[model samples]
Target: MTYNVQIKVMPLKDLLDPQGKAVMSGLQNLGLSGVEDVRVGKHITLRIDAETEEAAKQIADEASKKLLANPVMEFYEIEMIN
Candidate 1:
């Protein structure tokens, strides 16, 4: 069986995201108000061959830890989708 997985990678809350800051600045320049803050992140989708949802989730987690996210400055969340 194959499972669909989604990974969200984002900078740690304690860290500053330069890209997000730039985007916020751009938005303000465009006259967009009421936006207090912005954070930029990456969304990754993967199809994994596994027997069970748990197995697939584990694989995705391993992938995120190994290469998808930088543990030093970033964090990742994984979800199994239909």
Candidate 2:
């Protein structure tokens, strides 16, 4: 079977996100208050042939570790759809 995989890569929680901060401040200036602690992340979409969700997850994990995320300072999440 084929599964659609989506991987989201992002900086660690404690890391600085200047882009997100700028957007947050802009939103506040536009009268959109109560929004805090914004962070930006990347999304990757791909297709994989796997027998089960677990297998798809394993493939996504390897891809994330090797290419999608910077292991030293980044975190990642995976979503799979069949």
Clashes of each: 0, 0
lDDT (tens digit, per residue) of candidate 2 on 2-77: 8899999988998898878998999998999889678988989989888987898899999999988998889999
What is the TM-score of each predicted model, taking all chains together?
0.98, 0.82
The lDDT of model 1 is 0.96
lDDT of 2: 0.88
Between which residue pairs do clashes occur in model 1? Answer: none
Model 2, C-alpha of 14: deviation from truth (Å): 1.2
lDDT of 1 by residue, 1-82 (tens): 9999999999999999999999999999999999999999999999999998999999999999999999999999998888
**RMSD of model 2 against the true structure:** 1.7
